[model samples]
Target: MTRRAVFAGWWVVAGAFLCMLTGYAVAYSFAAFFGALESEFGARRGEISLVFSISAFLYFLLGFPAGLIADRTGPRPVVVGGLLLIALGLVAAAQADTLWQVYAGYGLGVGLGIGFSYVPSVAAVQRWFVRRRGTASGIAVAGIGVGTLVGAPVAHWLIAAIGWRHTYLVLAAVAVAGALLSGWLVRPGPERYGLTPDGDPPLPSGASTMPAGLGLGEAVRSGPFWSIYAGALLMSFGLFVPFVHLAPYASDVGLGEGFGVLLIVLLGVGSTVGRFLFASVTGWIGRRLSFALMYVGAAAMLVLWSQSTSAPALVAFALLFGAFYGGFVAIAPSLAADYFGGRALGSVIGALYSGVAFGALLGSPVAGYAYDFFQSYTGAILAGAALCLVSFAITLAMPEPARWLAARRPGP
Candidate 1:
């Protein structure tokens, strides 16, 4: 790649980070808004959660279509439009007073926006880097950490000061600026620049070709694909419970609410470090090993949550668990790339990501129901821990893809 191509590549990565910041600021920032929504809207916990759940569902449900759209159209405009919709959702949310309005803003508006942006950003990033794809993707998606660290605190402050309505307005402003910038920075792939995905030359003569892209039918038939899919589902099952419950759980145990928000920031710190660390290591350790470690380590961290009552203990739990969570964000996309070629990477990964959405659809409610039934988060934590163990096993079962093996074979 020329210096110009290299610069363009980094610019695209930067755009992915920006897109992630917007998406995650909305996704991860939900915790801070939960309490306010319950109080201001007179909705039950389940009802309030249903709004966000619907949003998560729509995001995952729409991932396949969005990926198809990105493949057929391009990444830049899709991302830009999605950010605009997110901004509109926030603005509409700022005006919401009824349950239906809340549903509209939180569920429909944000859900559709996330559908447009998140997967395309990753697909675009993967198309840019080949040799160091893991590292590149990690850095690109690390915007989740930045959003958590910065957006969580700002969200808390905004909620306290102007109330949730104006907070949405502020987020809307940020989203619009981000969308405008992303429109300029991002483009489809190296293909537009007369290069292939990963900047590789055309296939060499007599290279064995596996089926290029697996449809959902073919994907379901493959053992390795199902393994990766199952792992993602398990990861999501546990992923949001800690975050969604962290504030209320802390307050229930007599810790300050502010500390609950601070714990999120702490989690973000761990996430920032974890993304870089895991990305760097995946290139050395390889994908399967790194994925297996992430799940096993996450399970250990989830179990540690049962020991948390004090602020310090909880903080420790968050740090460790947060790293594992961020590690998944880094590795999962690369895992998709490894198992499937880059050909239908967007749609295939989108389908896999739907499994995550399904888990999220179940996770928070189960935790909430468990808390309501048992009057503690203990049962939920244990369940999540068990799910992490299951994910570890599934990841461990993944076979090395035939392509990676074929690439290593000696040629005549």
Candidate 2:
């Protein structure tokens, strides 16, 4: 067979992975820069944390529009545009001398850039696969973990050597290179290539193909969508709190700066493994059960994280939390596609991811404020654990989407 005949969808997966790796490397690497920004600006934790919170909010807030654009046009342009914005955001952030500048540059620019790239890439990947949707999505998102693993330590080293400003400049260059490379590779689904989703042959007589799911409005009005959204929002609340605070918290507990960054590395390791493992298993265990498992695991880990005071304990918390956290990230889009169908998958997934925006907006800064007020992370940790538990309950209570339920019933 010719090279193109071997299922070109995997090429889309590769492009999506590269885009995520580059974009998230810049996005998540903010944790490494968190302390430096605080020191440089003489800002409060809440203030520094707001940079990430704003970026995250815009990233998710814009997902709906980005996805709509992707649905109407295609993913390549969206991905390319996002990469340019990300580069510009980093460059502008590098030049910032004021908090408002940071907000505009990093928060608004980078946030919108990431938002533009994320949903489209994910939704595009969903459209390219059917039976293997879970595994394909998992593999694509594993880039986030890999990016974190590489980006966190590199950011730390660069900051120590050259300072955060230059580091941002360096990341900006990387973003440009990533965009140029991956943009060439990202295309729409199989139809563009004269194939079907998953590259499967035409179905035999009487075999049922899945229907296109609800329209954007119908999806919004559905109970299952909201259930997923609520669960995702709560889960994100628990997830990002530690992500932003873990570095600083390590320093507070006397683990030293090196250990603080090490925590991020460990989290990345666990996250990468979890995304691949948990999502791959969905073919066997199913999406709902897999999601519930991740929620419960994350909640349990957060409890452990709350009590952690030592290096080993924190390390354990990082691994467990990262695993479940990564699993949830990998599974969310797939779950949305499973319920909503691929017709309007971009818009549906984008709207659902807005939950992430709300969660991050509420979680990180509030945790920072709690720390500032009480001079302790105890309350923040407990709050995160509570959010995780709430998410767990919500996930359990979620019913199958109406489409899926209807599909399972016997036809006359």
Candidate 3:
């Protein structure tokens, strides 16, 4: 295809981006709703937090099966189905008269939708490009940054205007429309269209398009896999803490509600820039270094967060934390695909993210409990920073892609 023709893989990236944008916007926007939910239900911080915890746990936990199913079937159907569930869940949450109903509707429905759609959509993008894989993956997942950039503020505004129930209803409508459009844009792998990765050309009648790499079992048994898993698990324990508590912390410290929510907006901005910037630099600095630096930077920012009670300090923490976090998130898929092969890419990614899923389940709620016990966020913030240092240390031990492949390449 000519440069004028535009590659098919970019379209896949676009679709995946939109799917993630919708899913994560809805997912992360829970933070914006945190106060409202607590007020509405007359619940404590730790108890109300379980809603997000349940949602995160389900999506990450279910990602393994959801990915396997997508590997067998096409991602379009899976994404479409997931989006429908998200909309249904939002509608249910809108009508919820109790917290348990909210748990069922928002928690289960949104979680299941994301589980089914996220990994599959991401893996599909990886199949479309090799030369530009890093750039493509970063752009695709940057939807998360964009979504967060847009979703929380929008949700916050809507909540103030109409209240949280109606805000969810609005989000549901957006999710439904985005899902349909994204699913339509989502296509099968390049082979389905007789094209090679990066849209090189039409292949010979049966020219293999699949990249050679380790299968799920082989990948699971590797040291690199476990190391990556452990790193994600530890880093994740504090990852969602800010999303859930930043606003509340600001409130407690005397920053107004508007500014607290704006912190998330700035986070989105930094995250979007980081995704693009880091992806651009990956070819030069290399993935392992990028991965390690992200953790270190995140650790430093979390340390900053523990001390950030002033407006400028809080803003600095948000932007810096978001920049590092965005890079961290944008690189995961490409890193995993680089370590393993794309043979069962979706399932491998699903398995890897299970660590993150478990971490997310505990991250927010544990922070909430910490707040309840300590009456402050300092301990949790510091803990998250310490975990980041450990992640940095562990990831530092990882071998470069060439060495890793040389040492543990899969046999036919």
lDDT of each: 0.80, 0.86, 0.88
Question: Which portions of model 3 show Cα errors greater than 4 Å?
Answer: 1-3, 202-210, 409-412
Q: Is candidate 2 or candidate 3 better by lDDT?
A: 3
* Alpha carbon lDDT at 143, candidate 2: 87
RMSD of each: 3.4, 2.3, 1.8
Q: What lDDT tens digits, residue by residue, belong to model 2 across residues 266-385?
A: 888999999999998787877887888888898888889878889999999998888898999899998888788888889898999888898888788988888899998777777777
Model 2 ranges off by over 4 Å: 1-4, 202-210, 401-403, 407-412
Which pairs of residues collide in model 3?
A: none
State each candidate's clash count. Answer: 0, 0, 0
Tens-place lDDT digits, model 3, residues 1-412: 6457888889999999999999989988887898899999998888788888888888888788877888889789999999899999999999999999999999999999998888999999988878789999999999989988998899999999999999999999999998998999888788777788887765566554657678889989999899899999999989888887888888889987788889988888889889988887789989888998999999999999898789999889889889899999888889988888788888999998888888889988888998999898888889988998999999999998878897764677
TM-score of each: 0.91, 0.95, 0.96
Query: In what order do the candidates fall by lDDT, top score first?
Result: 3, 2, 1
How far is 262's C-alpha from truth in model 3 (Å)? Answer: 0.4
User: Whose TM-score is greatest here?
Assistant: 3
What is the C-alpha local distance difference test score of candidate 2? 0.86
